[model samples]
Target: MANRVDTLVATSPIKCAADKFYNFFKLNMNELVKIFPLAFTGVEVLEGEEGTVGCVKRWKYIIGGIPVSATVKIEVIDDAAKSITFAVLEGDVLLLYKSFKATLTVSEGSAQWTISFEKSTILTPPPELYIPLVITICTLVDAFLLVN
Candidate 1:
């Protein structure tokens, strides 16, 4: 397969540490993001098991109804070093990029979050794929605060 045309590195405005926002964040991350889909909008969490090793949060989203879909299984690897890695499994990313992943590490004294994505999607995505991801992420976080 050919390499994707783009790789985006998005940095968060605040630190990614164990705080109130972070705490509240865990309540429903997978579900919150799916509320924006114009058609299919639901995320089913298949598994959520946390232990001394790390936490595995697996989820998949069904978009544009049942047939059309894009799924994501995220393994949240939390280390004592104050860094977390989100390893994505299955879906288009798994197909185009065998080892697709994203990482969020603590920076600026854990007061800021730096997210870097290593993608293997099409050189020029149809925009639908990435656009929804960003919009969903932003909308979800925004809703988190407003609702609380």
Candidate 2:
């Protein structure tokens, strides 16, 4: 099966719109993505540009023991349309959804950012997959206990 743009979702944990979310993620992108690193552990950034290396940031991500790795070469394009275009240079799954470019537009303190993810299969396999049903139920129970 050929890799394609399989899934895309916009999350407003803070209810920020396009430009806001773009800037938010741009500033805190590293921190936000750190969640995945912490979850799986043994992940490392072998090489990457800190940020904005002449309009392009090169990022390299490696998960320990996983045969797959990703290197995204992101570039910001300021255009008449006022949107940023992010692209993946070379890495795993390049054939299936190799690049992603989107724009962030602000609307009432919330930004509507469109994230386009490329994938070969609808079932995009991760290195480690875990079921969260039990954990979610336990978390709800704990929250209820705190509330009551």
User: lDDT: which candidate is best?
Assistant: 1
Give the alpha carbon lDDT tens digit for every residue of 8-91 in model 2: 434232232334444443443454334444333232333544334223433434334344444444466453343454555556
TM-score of 2: 0.43
Error of 2 at 28 (Å): 3.2
Model 2 scores worst on lDDT over the 10 consecutive residues at: 126-135
lDDT (CA) per prediction:
0.44, 0.41
What's the TM-score of each model vs. the native?
0.52, 0.43
lDDT of 1 by residue, 1-148 (tens): 5543334454444422344334333444554544545533455544554321234444444443332333444446454444444555555445444454554443332323333344454452332354445445544455555465
Displacement of the residue 55 alpha carbon in candidate 2, Å: 5.8
lDDT score for residue 118 of model 1: 40
**In model 1, which runs have C-alpha deviations exceeding 4 angstroms?**
1-7, 12-18, 25-27, 33-40, 50-58, 62-83, 105-132
